[model samples]
Target: MMISDLPADLLDEILSRVPATSLIRLRSTCKQWYNLFKDQMFAEKHLRNVPKQLRVLTLKENRLFLPSVDLNFVPPSIEFSDELSLNNSNNSEEVHIDSAFHCDGLLLCTTRDELVVWNPCLGETMWIKHSEGSKRVKERKPMYALGYENNQSCRSYKILMFWDCDELYDGQVDGFKVYDFNSNAWRVVNYPNCFIMNSHGVNLKGNGYWNAYDDNYVDYILSFHFTGERFIRLCLPPPSQGCMYTSLSVVREELSVLRCVKGSSKIEMWVTTNKMDTSASELSWSKSFTMNFGFPVLVYTGLLIDEDKKVVLCNTIVGDHLRGACTIGEEDKYYSEIAFEGMSLSQPPHIFNYVPSLVRIQEGTELDVFGKSPRRRGDDPPTRRGDTAMCDHDFQFSQEIDDMMS
Candidate 1:
């Protein structure tokens, strides 16, 4: 029997297991399959049933380059794939993305004039216009984060637009706004000026996290809970002295932090021991492994760790000049440079782990959904950063909290 002759449910069961990239290309072959792939129910099934494939995405001059990675090799292997164009319309105008945020298989990208949420795997894009408040602060080019709230089987996605005011956070506190996909509108949200958000933000299980410091210069993890529409602070591992760079990544479904110390070749990896518990009094972190590259890694860079293989794939600087990507293994087990064909290493490109999904951005009236009201802050003990004991305010986020298998 022809594949098209299969029963409707049977066809969905088979197609749901196909990789997203393949499915996207094959959708044009059959009208029935095209409509089925667009069905929200089928998308959910595809998300739950299809195995995830992780790839490295690098953005250069608004161009997206996806490179295929092979971890079975010693130093690991990466090869150039394709340059993804964001412009899917008949107009030939190129899309220039200033920055991009990833959450739940969708990317929130900002350009010189507007913002858009994109599912590159499915070749889908949704434009989000700025609010009046956002336009007034356009010169600042407000930072953005994409996240969602899971209310039972439904997922409500939202975009957070806020300004980075570390220099003036103590005074003239600035408020932030949230753009609800369901409502297709923006609303201002209260901002807590107790801490200053720093560095790039990462999303974990529908929440947004960033490296932050307080007035006392204590560094911690700042988390914005979308479900609660409130900010909460989580603690980091004991601080490292002369730490020149810090970056966060989600590894094996848990949070991981990479600390690169100044003038030192030693890089330490810390993993959180528990899943994200927003209400926990303290988050725990344990040292995973360390990499000694024999040369100081002087800049902040993105990284992905293979827990079982004991290998780390990350962007690196060579000879204090050239930029490149490499894999670092434990105790001299291996170290090798990944060469990308036809891609420039002249500038450091943003790198992150990505899994394609069929999750669609829903549009409708906003639901009156709110999470358990913000947790009451208590007198938590001071969190230690190196030797300094930071006065742990209830809202100050922490570092080093991760998911470690053992």
Candidate 2:
């Protein structure tokens, strides 16, 4: 029997096991295979068949480097030779990526002028321009986040952008918008909170959460549900007076906060045990553990947590360099440094737990949705280096703190 004559179910089962990179090339063979590969059911099944691994993406010298992590066997230092650089032309203006956030397999990189959604695996990119209202508001910088929503019938990826407007109250913000990949259009949305902290939003499942505060200095968790296109406010643990720094992260699928308590050398980590319930009191914060670096000057930012190994990955400022450390279980309380050969630690890199996949940003839409031809592998546009260097204006930490640690 011919391959095209095979049963539909059997064909789907066979194609689901194929790797995403290869599927990109195979889709051109025929219209039937192309549609099957882009089907929601086929994509879900293909994702399940792919292995999940943790990798770190960092930027240095105007390029991106990705390195794999294995908790069981820690490496002295990670060395990355593979660089993901922009392929622009020598004549065109160079693009500077100020900050980046990862969701599923795609990365949302922000430049001064535009937002670029890039897929390193598929070598594809889509550029988006900021709204006209946002461009008019020059006081506050724009906030960007990449997230996905999945239901029984559809799976959608979206980009959210918002900025504070001076016309509103002190904490109030304006120019909130969302871009749907399927529609290739931007829609204005209501801004529920007064202000969102200038940090990357942590995405869990299909929702994104950020640490936000109001004019009264009251802190709360600002959550955005992608599927519903609505915002929900969740309460934070009562603030501890004189805390040095507090940051939010996603640990083992739960919302977690790392706070350095006042008048103490200990750093406390609290994880939300119950997140589904909307009540502020119902959302419980269970103390995961306390870390005392045994040095009065030590401060850390929680990066990722390996629950299975009982180890937490963190970045600590020591002297003039930023170092990576693994904090072991409570009883043992062991900390080990991750060794690396190149790259300066002066700037703390934005780190995220990345799982590579074959997910496409524009699967269900037509090729001309953006009024541009579809980009395939090896069709990258030429990139040129700009005269001026790009600075990390959105770097979360303050220079004063780094100076104090140094």
Candidates' RMSD to native:
14.3, 9.6
Candidate 2 C-alpha lDDT tens digits along 1-406: 9989999989888877765544554544565765676566677688767544445555544456554334444332334454456544233354566667777667887765667777655455666655442243456667678887776765688888777445444646666788887767778887663564634577777678777776666677788878778888777766678654455677655778766665565777778888542233335677777777655433434554456545555555555655454443343434555643364653355555555455666553344335653343323222322211111111111221122212
List the global CA lDDT of all models.
0.65, 0.59
The segments of candidate 2 whose C-alpha lies over 4 angstroms from its true place after superposition are: 1-37, 48-51, 59-62, 68-82, 89-95, 131-137, 164-173, 237-245, 275-282, 296-301, 317-334, 337-347, 364-406
Summing lDDT over every window of 10 consecutive residues in candidate 2, give the lowest-scoring window: 387-396
TM-score of 1: 0.76
Point to the candidate with the largest lDDT. 1
